[model samples]
Target: MLLTTVLIADFEKAGRATCQRLLQLEKKIKVVGEARCGLEAMTAAAKLKPRVLLLDPSGVEGEGVYLVSTILEKSPKTRIILLSERASDADILDALSQGALGYLAKPALASYLTKAVRAVAAGEAWVPRRMVGRLIDQLAPGQA
Candidate 1:
């Protein structure tokens, strides 16, 4: 059964396109609402109580992680996926530290994003392959 409700929080034309693509995959993901900013994302989370929150790191406020934290607090069951154009290690870690379940780059394929959503919905964490080395370097500076 597809029980995942996806809420997208992005403030760009690409964001809207992403939403449209997700809508096309309606059977796999149910998009409950869309928000153009982190603050609005929080409000939507509270109201929709979606299973997945597809958040863009470059939203209205410069504090997307903080917004993720708020969403977690407001809706403990909601899983946050930080979607962004940049794949910096700092960005990925910060979002993970803030309780985000996954991170994906902007140009990421819709299938990849959908896979992340399914994994997150099933209580798994995801970090994109392109940023894996960067993430490893940050997590274990001397180990790699």
Candidate 2:
């Protein structure tokens, strides 16, 4: 029964709180840290070294990309999941391209979020159903 440590990063306090509350219901999921900004998120990831990072890039003044890149560069073991309102096909593909292991929409149900965290922690990619083909195309071309 190993618990999965998670860091919640969002622009709004309520966003962080909502995720924290929802995730706490799962015994195996622990909310280790919360961040209200990209800088805080990066610092928390470095210091806390949580197993999963649930990042919402919306409030980061477009630095979300850089934040993700640096966090991964600094903490390669921290698997990042983008939990954002930006749900366009391009956004999904871009996030995955930028090294996120999972992407969930803003209104995601608690079950989906928890399931995604577990799946990503277990080394699997998670994405909305519609984006699966795009994710595959994005990842596979590089392997060829």
Candidate 3:
């Protein structure tokens, strides 16, 4: 079986653990690398070109937007999924504007996260249902 290479860009141990556990449970998503900060995340993404990037907004010096934009600029094919606790309107707006394909709250549920990654890898946006309305209403069309 060919597993998708998923690179995790979360500074916290718990965030990494969550990705590790989910990949372990599913066995189809392999974590190829990890980064503790936004700069490292960009570097790793550029070098590894993983299929998915799990980003922790809080870990990136609150510069998730910049990191997402940079990665998409350098590695346009990489799918970015923001992993965070606070998905405030501002955060969501920023992420969407910067081309983030999805956002997942922390303490991520395994099934949902897996589905999200697949959706993103398939070139589909996967925002939480609760935030879909907000994205449509507030975010610019064709932003991502």
Candidate 4:
């Protein structure tokens, strides 16, 4: 199996460590870089060109949406996976609107996150099924 290179950008040491540990536990996933802030993430994303970027919004100093779009702009092929504790409809929708390919609510199970990373790396969206209908409703021309 081809390994999926993942760049984890979390502000706190513990957060980064936990994510790195979980990802390392997955044989097919390899963590290639770690960043503590938005600038570092952009730099790492540009240099490493990881297949997936796991970003924790709270860890990034500036606006999370900007980071998402900027990262996409810099690395067009990189699929961004947002990790956050905020599970509100608006938060998830906002991240998706800004070019994030996946959103895993904080406290997410390790198995689910691993699967999400693989799915997103393969060019698939990794949003929960429950959010699909609402997302469609919100994005549909007449509904929004």
Candidate 5:
């Protein structure tokens, strides 16, 4: 099986540890690098060019959404998955708007997180099921 490499950008020690532990259970996923800040994340992305980047932008230096765009600019092919405690609809929309392929609320189940990573690596978008309606509403207002 082809491995899906992942780079994690989370400042909290526990957050990174939790992600590492949960992702390790999946044989197809490999953790390539970890970054504690946005600059490190950008450098890692440019250097490693991992298939997926699991980022918690809240811990980064600049605005979360801006960081998303910056990272993509440097590593356009690297798929980003935003894992944040902020799950508000607006936050989810902003993340998606900024080019994140996946958005998962923090404390997400390992199954869901790994599934999201796999799906994003395969070039599919992953977001909370409830947000689908909101996204559709925004995309086609008053149509559906």
Candidate 6:
């Protein structure tokens, strides 16, 4: 079976471990690399070119949204999923606007994280169900 490569960019050991454990359950997903900070993430993204990037911006050097854009600039084909504990609606929308393909809350469930990785790698957007209405509202504005 073909494998979808994933790069994890998270500073916390616990966060990385959780992601790795969750993703490992899926036979089609393979973790190619990991980064502890923003610069490492940028370099890894360029070098590994993983199919999906799971990013937690709290440990990054610059702003989370900026890192997302920068990574996308370097590896345009790599899909990105933002994982955060304190992600507000505005923050999620901003990252999505900056080219993030997915967003998941920190401590993401295994099902959601794996599903998101697969969806994003397949060129689809992934966000929590609760955020769907808000996302639609943001994207369509008056229409929602």
Error of 6 at 22 (Å): 1.5
Among the numbered candidates, top lDDT falls to 5
Tens digit per residue, CA lDDT, model 4, 19-117: 888888888999999999889999999999999999988866566766899998899899999887666777778889999999987688465888899
Error of 5 at 3 (Å): 1.0
Best by TM-score: 5
Can you tell me which runs of candidate 5 are displaced by over 4 Å?
Answer: none
Each prediction's Cα lDDT score? 0.80, 0.85, 0.82, 0.87, 0.90, 0.88
TM-score of each: 0.84, 0.91, 0.87, 0.91, 0.94, 0.92
Displacement of residue 76 (Cα, Å) in model 6 is 0.5
lDDT of 1 by residue, 53-103 (tens): 888868656666777788899888899988887856777888888899898
Which tens-of-lDDT digit does each residue in 1-144 have in candidate 2? 689999999988888888988898999999998988888999999999999999998888865665777889878899999987666788767777778888887787465888898999999998888887766667687542
Candidate 5 lDDT trough over 10 residues, lowest sum: 104-113
Off-target runs (Cα >4 Å) in candidate 4 are 141-144
TM-score result, candidate 2? 0.91
Candidate 6: residue 98 lDDT (0-100): 93
Query: 1-144, model 5: which lDDT tens digit per residue?
Result: 599999999989888898999999989999999999889999999999999999998986567767889899999999999988876788889889999998988877565889899999999999988888888988999865
> At residue 59, what lDDT does model 1 achieve?
61
lDDT (Cα, tens digit) per residue for candidate 6, span 11-39: 99888889998888888999999998889
Q: Which sections of candidate 6 miss by over 4 Å?
A: none
